[model samples]
Target: EPEVTQTPSHQVTQMGQEVILRCVPISNHLYFYWYRQILGQKVEFLVSFYNNEISEKSEIFDDQFSVERPDGSNFTLKIRSTKLEDSAMYFCASSLLPTGSEAFFGQGTRLTVV
Candidate 1:
């Protein structure tokens, strides 16, 4: 079965630097999303993309965060001006339907802000 794949399983960056996390969702899935889990916290929704545009976003996805489907198969999340609180395991997910369906998730990219 095809699955979401994320690059650089572990990423370490300076507090003021920028980071771009990448993901390749399942080839046939139509909806894609970015979610993050702070060390011991619950998974939080960041944003969702469909039809090459942002479909939904949470407050957590402020100006500092952006998501893009730069091509037919790649989805990416960029965090500008990383902060200590930004350290977390960011997960990439895709689903055939926006709701009432299972969403496949990647292993996740652990972002560590120093």
Candidate 2:
């Protein structure tokens, strides 16, 4: 079966640098999303993209973060300016349903900001 793959299971970054976490989503899905979970917080949705443009974004998706589908199979999330508070497990998910679908997640990209 196909699955979403994320690189760098763990990442450590300085407080002001940039970080790009990569993901290869399942081959046949139509909707893609990025969500983050702080060490002790709830999973929060950052943004969702479809049709090569942003379909929806949550408040946490501020100017410092951006996402792109650089090609047909890969999706990427870029943080322009990392902050200590940005340390969290970033998850890439895909689903066939626009909303309320069960999403499958990668093990996760654990970003540690210092």
Candidate 3:
């Protein structure tokens, strides 16, 4: 089965540098989302995209964050100014469904801000 894939399994960045995490969601999926886990914290939703536009976004998706689909299969999340607290495991998920449907997650891109 097709699955979501993320790059940079681990990343270390200065406190104020820019970062871009990449992902390739399932081929037939209709909904895409970004979620993060801060160490032992619970997984939190950052944003959701569908039809090439943002469908939903959490407060965590502040001005410093942005997302894009640069190609047919790649989805990317960019942080313009990374902060120390931004250190976390960012996961990409996709589903050919709505909010109530089950979603599949990528291994994740670990971003460590120093």
Candidate 4:
């Protein structure tokens, strides 16, 4: 079985710094998404991408953030500026079907800002 992979399993950044979280979503999938979970909170959707454009996004994916698939294989999330509240475990998920299909998720990248 194949799975999504994220680099730097954990990251530590300064409050005002920039961070780019990287992920390689499942191959041959049609939809890809980024979701995050605050330390003790439920997982929440951040953004969804398909066909080289953003298909959907949550409020949390404000101007401060952006997502792009620079290459066909890697999906990246960039935070222009980091904040204490931005710290969370970010997950990358992909599915062949747009909806109603099982989404495969990466282990998650834990971001810590201080």
Candidate 5:
């Protein structure tokens, strides 16, 4: 069995700086997504991608955020300017099934902005 993997398990950045979190999803999955969990909050969806285009995105994925599949095997999420509020654990997930199906998720990239 394969799993989604994210690089830089933990990161600390200064406010206003840029950060790009990287992920490699399960090879057979077709849909990819980015979600975030604040220190003690529930996970929230940020964006979803399918067939190389964005299928859906939440308000959190605003002008300050962007996601891309630069190559066939990797996906990345970038925050143009980090904010203290952006501190959270970001998870990358992928699914072979439909929208609500269970997906494989990465360990998460913890981002702390100060």
Candidate 6:
């Protein structure tokens, strides 16, 4: 089965720096999303994209965060500046439908901002 793949399973960066987390979602899926878990916290939705546009986004996805589908097969999340509180396990997910469907998630990129 096809699955989402993320680069650099673990990333360590200094505060105030920038980081771009890359992902390759399932090819046939129509909806893509970015989610994050801050250590022991529950998964929080960051943003959702469809048709190459942002369909939805949470307050957490402020001006500092951006998502892009640079190509047909790649989806990426970029944090313009890193903060200590931004450390978390960021997950990339995709679903065939907008709702009521299973979303496949990648192993996640563990981002640690020092």
Per-model TM against the reference: 0.98, 0.95, 0.97, 0.98, 0.96, 0.98
Reference-based lDDT, each prediction: 0.97, 0.92, 0.95, 0.95, 0.95, 0.97
Model 2, TM vs. native: 0.95
Residues 38-74 of candidate 5 have per-residue lDDT tens digits of 9889999999999988999998999999999999999
> Model 4: per-residue lDDT, tens digit, 17-100?
999999999898989999999999999999999999999999999999999999989999999999999999999999999899
In the range 1-114, model 1's lDDT, one tens digit per residue, is 799999979999999899999999999999999999999999999999999999999999999999999999999999989999999999999999999999999999999999
Pairs in clash, predicted candidate 1? none
Task: Evaluate residue 103 in candidate 5 and report its C-alpha lDDT on the 0 to 100 scale.
Answer: 85
What is the model-wide C-alpha lDDT for candidate 5?
A: 0.95
Instruction: Extract clashing residue pairs from model 2.
Output: none
Better of 1 and 3 by TM-score: 1
Backbone collision tally, model 2: 0
Candidate 3 ranges with C-alpha deviation above 4 Å: none
* RMSD for each of the candidates: 0.5, 1.0, 0.7, 0.6, 0.9, 0.5
